[model samples]
Target: MIACLRLFSALCLAALLAACASSPSSSLGELPRTPDATIEQLLEQATSAKTPEHAALLRLSAADMAFQQNNPARSAQILAQVPLDSLKPAAQIFASTLTAELAMGRNQPKAALAALSHPSLQNLKELPPEQQIRTGTVHARAYEADGQTLAAARERVAMAPLLTGDAAASNHEAIWSLIAAVPGEQLQASGNPVLDGWITLAQAIKNAGTLEQQQAAIDTWRAQNPAHPAAVQLPTPLTRLKELASQPLNKIALLLPQQGPLASVAKALREGFMAAHYQAQQAGQKPPVIEVYDSSRVSSLDEFYKKAQADGVQLVIGPLEKPLVKQLSARPQLPITTLALNYSEGDQAPAQLFQFGLAAEDEAREVSRRARADGLHRAAAMVPKGEWGERVLKAFRQDWEANGGTLIGVEYVDQPVALAQQIADLFKLRQSEGRAKSLQSTVGADVAAQPSRRQDIEFIFLAVTPQQAQQIKPTLNFQYAGDVPVYATSHVFSASGDKNQYNDMNGIMFCETPWLLNTTDPLRNQVTAQWPQANGSLGRLYAMGVDAYRLAPRLGQLKALPDTRIDGLSGNLGMSPSQRIERQMPWAKFVSGQIERLPDTPR
Candidate 1:
C-alpha cells in the first residue's frame, strides 16, 4: 500500500508541473516587456514560437511596438497576422485596444469605438492596470472625437483610479473640460456619484449670476463633495475664473454706425445689447455701463481708442463696418481690448482684437462638418452668382476637401431661366440622356429611358435666398434629384412663416441661429415684444448682438481655455486661434410645409 501511494503522488506532481508549464506567463514567454524592444526581434521570435498562442502573443507585441514607432501601416500588417479568436482573453483585449488606437490614428473614431467593443474587453480587468489605462485612454479619445462629450468624461472619470502623477492630473483636467463643454440642457445627473458631482459643479458655475455668486457656488459644491477629484483640486479654468473675479468689467464702449448704410443693422444690435443689460439688472446684478459711439461720425480709429480710454472703457465692443475692422486688424496692438463686431479679411490680427459676427462662412463650414458626420463624402454646391456666393463656396470647398470630401460639381445660380439647365448639368442628367440616345441610335429605335442624375453626388450644398430656395428645391425634383439631401445656410430660411412658400422648400435642411429656432428664450421674447421685426431674419443680427454682449466678459476666459464654448443665443460660440468667434448652429428641416428642429449634429 505504501508503494502504491508513492506512485500516485508522483503522477499528481507530474500533472501539476504540466499545468504550470502551460500557464499564461510561461505560454507568452519571450513577449517583449517594453515597446522599445526592436519590432524585428519580436517578429523573428514570433516566427519560431512553439505554440499558436505564443505566436499571437509575440505578433501582438510586435504590432504594438510598430505602432509606438509610428509605423501604423506596419502595425496594421502585424496586427492582421494575429488570430484574435484563438488567443487568450488578455491577448485578445490587447489586440482590440491596439486596433482601436490604429483606427483613431486614421481619424476613424467610429471604427475605433467598434474595435474597442470586442467581447474580450469584458475580461479587461484581468489584465495589468497599465493595459486597462491604455484601453481606457483610447476609448475616451474616440468618444471625444465622435462628439460623445459626456461619454468621454465618464471614461476619463473611470480611469482616475488607475492613473497617477502628471497622467492623473491631466486626466482629471480633461474630465472637467469635457463636462464643461457640454450644453447646459444636456447636463443631467447620471446615477454615478462621481460623474454627478462633476455635473453639479458645472451646473453651479453655469447658472450662477455673478462672479461672486459663481465663486460661492464653487465653494458650496466643494464643501458638499469634499472627496471629489475636482473638489480636491479645482480645474485650471475654475482657478482662472477665481482670479478674474477680482477684476470686473465696469464699463464698455459700443462703437457702431448710426447713420450709414448699416444704421438699421446697428439699431437692432444696440437694442439687443441693451435688452441683455436690462435683464441682468433685473436679476439683481451690477451690470456694466454701456456707452454708444457712432463709427460713421468718427474719422479716425486712433482718436476713438483715445476717447474710449478717457471714458474708462474696459472694453470696446465694436465698429461694425468692414472698413473699420480692417483698420483695427492692421494695428499691432490697441489701447483697450476691442471685440469688433465684424471680422477682418486678413488672417492675422492684433492679440487684443477679438472678432465676432454672423459670418455666413461659419454656416458653410458647418455644412461640411455635418455632412461628413452623416457619412456623406461627395457634394455639389449651388450658390448665387456674386462675391457673396464665391465667399461661401470657398469656405465650403476648403472645409470639405480638408475632411476628405469630394466637391464633385458646382453650379452658379444667377437667373431663374437657367435653373433647370444648371440642375440637370450638375447631376449629369444630360450625359445620361446622351448615352441613352447613342444606344437607341445603334439599336435603330427609340429606347424608353428616364434621364437619371449621377449616382456619385451624395448631397447638394444650397446657398440662396428663401425665394431662390423655393424655386430651386422644386427644380431639383424636376431634374430627378429630389431624393438627394439638400443642406443650406441660415440665408435659405426667411422666417417668413408662409406655408405655401415653405411647401416648395420641403425636404431641405438648414442651420439657423438659436434665437430664431427657440422663440421661448426670455431675452428673445422680450426683445421680440419690443421690436416685432426681431421675430424675422433680423433676429439673427439681434442674436449676434446679444452674443457680443455675452462674449465681451468671457473673451478672456475663452482665450485662456482653448476648449471653452459658450452656449450663446447665436450658436454654440467658440474662439478660434485667430481671435475670430466661430459658431455651431442648430439644424432644422422643412417637412410638409412646417419647420421641424433636428437634433444637434456632431461638431
Candidate 2:
C-alpha cells in the first residue's frame, strides 16, 4: 500500500512538470487571462494547450485585444514569452506589430523600431495596401523613437506611391504625396493622418461630384474634428492641381504684375507663360486667346475680378503679390476658374484660388520629409537670419516633429544675431533635442550586435541657397558629413555665387518636378531639347502654359462640376472637391550637379 501511494505522487509531479514544459511560456495550466482577459483564466487555458504554438497563438489573440484596450506593457510582457514561428504569416505579422507597439509604449522607441524592422515583420508587406500602410507607419514611428529618422522618412516617401498607384485615381497620388511630406513616430491613437485622408477620399471618390465638392466635403469633415485625418500634409487639393492639360483652350488670363516694382519677377513669369502659350499653338493644341491683365492697372483685386467677369475670361492665373491674393479670398464667387500664383507675403488665398509658388513653408516641409525618409534624423539648418530664418525654422520644427524627428538646431547666418550667438544657438538646439544620447549611443544595437563597421546617416536636408550652401557644405564635410549623406532644397539650385557653386556642391539630395526628368514622353522631350535656346525659366513657363491651356476652356465645366480632376503637364492634378488645385509633388536627388529621380517617384 505504501508503494502504491508513492507511485501516484510521482505521476502527479510528472503531470505538473509536463504542463510547464509545453510550448508558449505559460503552459496549459490555468494560463492567466490576458490582462484584458482574466489573466488567471488565460494561464489555465494556455497551459492546457499541448503545444507552444497553440499557447502562443492564444496569447497573441489576447494581447491584440489588450493593446486595443491601450495596455501595451501587459501585452508586451505576454508576447515576450511566445515564439511566433508556429503562427501563420498574417498572425506572425500581427504578433510582430503588437510587439513593436508594446516597445513603443514602454518609451523604448529604438526597440520598437528594431522590432518593426525584424525579418519576421517583413511578411507584413503581404497584407493589403491599407494594412501595409497602417503597419508600415507603426514601423516608421518605432524608428523615429529609436532616433532612426531617415528610415522612418523613407517609409513615408515609399508609402505615397504605394497607397495611391502612379496613375491618377481620384487624385490619390497627390493626396498621398502631400501626406508623406510629414513623417515621425506613430503614437496616434487613431492612425497616420495622410493614410487616413487618402483612404477616406478613396472611399468617397466614387460618390463625389467634382474635385471641388470633394475638397469641401473633406474640409467639412475636418471641421467636425472626429473624421479629421491624422496626416500633416492633408491631400489639401485632394485632386489634381491641373485643370487644362487634356482639354481644349478657350481663354486664359496671365495675372502677374506686368507693370510693377517686381516687374522682373513678373516678366519672368510672363515670358514663361507666353512661351507655353506659343508652344501650345505649335503643339496642335487648340490655342486659347491669351489676355494680359496689367495687375499694375488694378488698384485692388476686387476691381480686377470685376473686370475679369466683364471680359468673359474663362480662367485666371496670378496676382504674384500676397496682399492681392489675400483679397480674393473674401470674394471667391468669381465666374471663372482662378489659378493664382503664390508669393512670400502673408496672403491667404481663397479656397477657389489655386496658389502655386515655392513658399518657405512648403520648402521646409519637403526637406524635412525627404531627409527624415532617407534616415537622417539629425538636422542643423543654417538660414538667413530674421523673417526668413523664422519662417523656415517654424516649418522645420513643425515638420521635423511631425516626422518623428528633432531638430539638431538652427544656425542663423543673419548679421544682427552675431556670429557667437548663432553658433551658440546651433549647439544648444542640438544638445536640447537629445543629440547627446544620439551621438554617444550606438545607432542600432542589432546592427552593432552583428560583426560589421557599416555606419551611415541616410540624408541631411540643408535649406540654403547657392551662396550660403557653398559656405556651409565644407563645414558639413569637415565637421558634420562624416559618412553621413546630405540633402538640400530647390534653393540649392540657385546659380553659383562668386564662383563654381555647383562644383563646390557635392553629396546633397533635392526634389523637383517631372519637368527635370529625361523622359521619353514627347512633351517632355520637346521641352528638354528646346530649353537650351530659350530663356532661363523657359521650361517652367511651358509647364504653366500646358496646364493653363488645358484649364482655360474647361473653366465653365470646372465651376459647374468641381469634382472632376485630371492629369496635367506638371504632374497628377486634383482639386479638393473644393476648387483648390491639388498636386502630387515629386522629389529628386542632386548628385554633383545632376538631379536623379528617387526610386519611389510616381511613374
Question: Number of the top candidate by lDDT?
Answer: 1
Candidate 2 lDDT over residue span 384-479, tens digit each: 768877887787789788767866655667453254434434434344334445544656432222111112224445666666666566655444
Report the Cα lDDT for residue 550, model 1. 88
Per-candidate Cα lDDT values, in order, are 0.89, 0.56
- Name the Cα RMSD for model 1: 7.5
Candidate 2's displacement at residue 404, Å, is 1.8
Question: How many backbone overlaps does candidate 2 show?
Answer: 65
lDDT at position 304, candidate 1:
87
Using Cα atoms with residue i matched to residue i, what is each candidate's TM-score against the true structure?
Answer: 0.70, 0.50
Across residues 1-603, which tens digit of lDDT does each residue of candidate 1 receive? 999999999999998766544333443332225645688888888899898877788788889888988999999999999887887667777888999999999999999999999887877665567887999999999999999999999999987999999999999889988988887788899998999999999888878755677789999999999999899999998898888777899999999898978999999998899888898899998889999999999998889888889999999999899998998999898889999999899688988999999999999999998999999999999999989999999999999998789999999999999999999998889999999999999999989999988899999999899999989999988999999999999898989999988899999999999999998899999999999999999999899889999888888777645556888999999988798999999999999989999999975
